[model samples]
Target chain A: DVKVTQSSRYLVKRTGEKVFLECVQDMDHENMFWYRQDPGLGLRLIYFSYDVKMKEKGDIPEGYSVSREKKERFSLILESASTNQTSMYLCASRRQGPEQYFGPGTRLTVT
Target chain B: DQQVKQNSPSLSVQEGRISILNCDYTNSMFDYFLWYKKYPAEGPTFLISISSIKDKNEDGRFTVFLNKSAKHLSLHIVPSQPGDSAVYFCAANIIQTGANNLFFGTGTRLTVIP
Candidate 1:
């Protein structure tokens, strides 16, 4: 079975504070992705990494950045968190297939 | 632009009946479709999938039916149990876009009453 784990299941941060969400996968998948899910808006892609040093911006990458220094780890960074950035963050990893295994997700609340 | 759409926000079904969840897509480039079930406070889990070449795919109690002409697909769970209740999301895999990102719908929350 494939397992993906996140650093935190719930987080609280103040406005303008820097926040980091970490994701780790044990399947050695090449594709990793970060998505923010909101009610009525669905899950929107924030960023995706195809390799350890390769990354691409997704549809909603405005207030976020990503780091993929290693294959098993993918981290999402919020340079300066805002109240609007509060959302459920999900990390997924896949290997040359359509099926993506996702982590438990981190619910970030920016106050 | 919401390429994948699940118009229904929720569905209710009896424990022994069949639960049908629908999904529609506007992009013709989508060649692969998948269904994912998500529980509260957890990430979406893969349920079943069907490629454009096939019209139907079945996995135990879950069956996926696809209509290429209408660009639509539906997932049916037979003998629905309480454990089957969850938010089901439909996702599409776009081809030739140089990216393998799967576009997802808003999701439909299914409630299976005992």
Candidate 2:
């Protein structure tokens, strides 16, 4: 079984603060993704890393950045947390196909 | 533009009945589709998948049916249990350029009453 673990299951931050969400996968998958899920908006991709040090912007990447210094870890960074950024964040990893394993999401609250 | 769409926002079914969740896609380039189940406070988990070449794929009590001509797919779960209540999402993928990104639907919340 593949295991994808997120650093924090719940987090709270004040406005204008910096926030980080971490994800690690034991499968050593080459593809890792960060997504924010909101009601009626669906799971919109924020950023994705196909390989170490390589990142690409997804549909909604504004105010967000990603780091993939190692193959097993991926991190999502918020430059300045805002109230609009409060939502459930998900991390996923896949080998080379559509079947992706996901970690238990982190619910971030930006007050 | 929303490439993947799930028209129904929610559905309710009684225990031991069949539950059908539908999904549609506007992108004809997508060659693969998958279904995922998500509970509150948890990430979506892979349920089942079907390739464009095949019309149907089944695993245990879950089955996915795809209609390439209509660019649509459906997931059917028999003997629905109360524990199966969750949001179901449909995703489509195309690997033509080596970038395997999935386009997902808004998701349908299914509730099974005992």
Candidate 3:
């Protein structure tokens, strides 16, 4: 089975603090993605990596960055968490197909 | 702007009835469509998908119908049980890109009363 796991199910951070969200996929997929789900806004992409050491910015990449040192793992870094950045973060991986498998998602609250 | 849109924010249906969820897209280049189901605090799961070449696709109780001319699509869940209650999201992508990128619409929350 293709399993995607996230580092945290819930997190609390103060303003201006750096936060890191980790995602690991067991299926050795080539593409990984980061997205934030907000009410009314839906799921907006933040970043995606096609391969190790290669990344591309998605529609909403501001205030966020991603790293893919290994094919099985992807990390999303928030330079400085803000109150407006509080939301559920989702990670996904796909293998040369239109369907992308997603992680359970991390719900972050910035105060 | 959102390329894909789910105008309905929520829908309620009784058990053993058909639940139809609608979605629309403004882009004509999208060649593939998919539907995902997400529960609270969990990731969205792939439910069904359809290619542009076909007008309809079905799997068991789930069926997806596409209207290319209207740039619209619908998902029909027959005999929807309470277990089907969740958020349903419809997504689209251009198969030619091969980038695994998808444009998702604002999801519609489904509530099935048993």
The lDDT for every candidate, in the order shown, is: 0.95, 0.94, 0.96
Please report the candidate that would top DockQ against the real structure.
3
- TM-score of chain B only, all predictions? 0.96, 0.97, 0.98
True contacts kept of each: 0.69, 0.69, 0.76
Docking class of 1: medium
Q: Write the per-residue lDDT of candidate 3 for residues B29-112, one digit (tens) a residue.
A: 999999999999999999999999999999999999999999999999998999999999999999987746899999999999
User: How many steric clashes between backbone atoms does each model show?
Assistant: 0, 0, 0
lDDT of 2 at A56: 95
How well does candidate 1 reproduce the true complex, by DockQ?
Answer: 0.79
Least accurate stretch of 10 residues (summed lDDT) in model 1 chain A?
Answer: A93-102
**Model-by-model DockQ, in order:** 0.79, 0.80, 0.87
Ranking, DockQ, top scorer first: 3, 2, 1
Task: State the displacement of the C-alpha of residue A44, model 2, in Å, after optimal TM-score superposition.
Answer: 0.6
Tens-place lDDT per residue, model 3, A36-104, is: 999988899999999999999999999998899999999999999999999999999999889999999
Q: Summarize candidate 1's per-residue lDDT along A52-106 as a digit string, tens digits.
A: 9899999999989999999999999999999999999999999988889999999
